[model samples]
Every structure is written in structure tokens, then in C-alpha cells.
Target: MGEVLQKRFPDMVALFTGLGFLTVLAELVLMDHREGIRILAPLAAGLGAGAILLGLGFPRGRVWATGLLLLVGGMGLLGLVEHMQEALEASSPSVVRLVDEEGWEYPAYPGPLREGEKEGSPPPLAPLALSGLGLLGALALHARKP
Candidate 1:
């Protein structure tokens, strides 16, 4: 198994990168974009695509691919930090009013809103997936026998 993986590492990396890119793109589209950070949605998608292309050997160079992968990884780390900060800042305790089916209204205390549940936020851990994939590709490229 180890030998097989070592020999087919590039193909595996390419396949996983393409799948991850598609998944991220679909998720971004589904999550929709806020006016403030709308540009970031497309930017992330573009970067993911570029990484996929590099992983798939489209341009055929390890150094270029490694650089792009590292860049993507860094962006993911930045995003994770931003998301955690936003979540922390918005986590003050609060009471929300709820209306029941019987048309009765009551004050309900709820836990802090999660990452993407808040307005204009992305999932807290979503960026980590990008980071992991990027780092994995970079490391795989570096480790593969030339």
C-alpha cells in the first residue's frame, strides 16, 4: 500500500484537490455572499481552482505548484483566525424572542451563535479544510519521487 501510494501520489493529490475545489465552490455559492465580503467568495474560489490546476499538472512544475499551495494554505489560516475572532466578538449572551405555533411569544435564552449562523459569517472550521488540503498537496508534491 505504501509503495502504491508513493507511486500514485500525484494522481491522488490532483483528484482530491479537484474534488475539494468543487466542494468549496458549491458551498460558497450555497452560503451566498454578503455585500461587505462578496469579493472574498470569488477570490477564494479562484485561488482554489488555481491550486487544483497546479496539482493536476496543467503547467507541470513542482516549484510553482508548491508556492501556490502554500499561499492557499496561508489564506486559509488567515480566514480561520478571522472567523474565530468574529465568532468571539459576537458571542455575548443575549435573549431572543420566539413565537410559538399558538401565537404566544416568549423570551428564550440561547447559546452563542456559531460561526456561519451569524449574519455575514462563514463556518468557523470551513477554512481549515482548505488549509489542510493545500498543505497536503504541497507536502505530497515535495515528497513524491521525481
Candidate 2:
């Protein structure tokens, strides 16, 4: 069992890292259709492709997988920090004005707002978690002897 696991560890890490990239790509495509997605989408897709290639036991698979995982993990950490900051700032009863899709303005919280609560989209926790998992898996693979 140990030998089998050691032999397949890199492949497993690469596969999971690819899945993580795909998750981020899907999130960006579905939830965020901003103009910047044109660049981000393709970049994410490329990363996912690279990860899959690495999983196929390429010559530099370890390097590619490690680099991609670290990059995604770093980005997720940055986004998590930003979201935490926003959440902290939002933990107050403040009147928020929002525009509807039909170009109508309305208060976000019509009734009495509670402290440390707001009506807004939640943070991208899924991607953050996935990235962290991928990073850890990559690190584990890196630690193993090639």
C-alpha cells in the first residue's frame, strides 16, 4: 500500500490541482461575467490544462504542478483577505443603496438592520478551500522523493 501510494502521489496531486483550477474557472465563468474574465477565464483554463498534462507524468510534472498550486493558493489567500476585510467593514447597521437590474434604486435592507449583518453576496469560500487543498496536496507531493 505504501509503495502504491508513493508511486501515485504525484498523479493524485496533479489531478486534484487540475480540479481546483477547473472549480475556479467555473466560478469565474458562472458567477463573475465581468470584462476581466476574458483574460482570467483563459488563464484559468490554461492552468487547468497544464495541470492535467502534468498528471500524465510529464518530464517536469512536479515543477509545473507545484508552481500552479502555489499560485492558485496565493491568489485564494489574497481574495480571502479582501473578503474578510469587506465583511468586517460591513458589520455595521448602515443604509445601503443598491440598483436593481431594471435600473431602479432601493435600499438593500428595508427593515431595521441588525448589527454585524448586511444583505450582500457571500465570499468565494469554495474556491479558497479548493485552492488550499490543492496547495497542500502539491506540497506533499513535492516532499516525497521523486
Candidate 3:
């Protein structure tokens, strides 16, 4: 079972790599953000690295897997940064737009005005911290030899 899992894991990673790249590509090209996008480069790099790592599954797959996990952690950190920025923006009206009819419009930010602001913590931070820990574990495992 252990050897079978090891053999199948890389194939799963390859499938996930293809799907993730497509999703990110779609977001980059299609989704329109009210505020300008940030952290595109780091996320892109991570995705690219992951795809390469997934592709290199035939030999030294464990090394590539370690690299893939690191990149995943880096991308998660980027997301945490984004959520923190959102938390800041939640307090103030950072942007204003003028419309011919409405005169001025402020896109709603999460806050006391928005429901559930204080109920729960920012979503990304939890997973991001977990990712960091996982990255560390991956590094330790990579360094250890059987």
C-alpha cells in the first residue's frame, strides 16, 4: 500500500497541477478586480514551479514534491498578505468612483457595516499559517534520509 501510494501521488500532483494552472490563468485573464491585483508574480511563480515539479515525477519525485510544497507555502503567504490588506481596507473607504447618476460610489468593505465581520477571523490566514508549518515539515523530511 505504501509503495502504491508513493507511485500514485505524483500522478495526482500532475492532475492537480494542470487544473490549478487553468484556474489561475482564468482568474488572471477573466476576473475583474475592483481594486488592482497584487501578488500575481509570486503566485504565478509558485504555480509554474508546481507544474514543473509535478511533471518531473519519474525521478527524484520527492525532491520536486518538497519544492512544490515550498512554493505552495509561499503562495499561501501571499494570500495571507492579501487578506490582511483587506482587513485594513475594511475600516476605511480607500477608493471612490464617480458615476454619472450616483455622483460618488464606494464599494462595500467588510466591517461593522458588513455582517459577520467580527464573528470569524480572516479566512486566508488560518490556511496560510498551516501552509507555513507544512512547508517546514517538508523541508525537514527532505533533509532526513532513510
Q: Pick the TM-score winner.
A: 1
Q: Would you estimate the TM-scores of all the predictions?
A: 0.67, 0.58, 0.43
Error of 2 at 127 (Å): 4.6
Local error of candidate 2 at 133, Å?
Answer: 3.4
lDDT tens digits by residue: candidate 2, 1-146: 99998787866665665666666667666865345423444354456446555635665576776677567566556656656766677665456799989999986755754695447744646446645655765675576456
Candidate 2 CA-lDDT value: 0.60
Error of 1 at 15 (Å): 1.8
Query: Which scores higher on TM-score, 1 or 3?
Result: 1
Better of 1 and 3 by lDDT: 1
Ranking of all predicted structures according to lDDT, beginning with the best and ending with the worst = 1, 2, 3
Give the range of the ten consecutive residues with the poorest summed lDDT in model 1. Answer: 33-42
Instruction: Assess candidate 1 and give its lDDT.
Output: 0.70
Residue 23's lDDT within candidate 1 is 79
lDDT of 1 by residue, 1-146 (tens): 99998788776776677578677767767766435644464466567667666655654676787777778788778778877877777665456899999999998877666775654444678778778877877776676555
Model 3 ranges off by over 4 Å: 1-9, 32-58, 61-65, 94-146
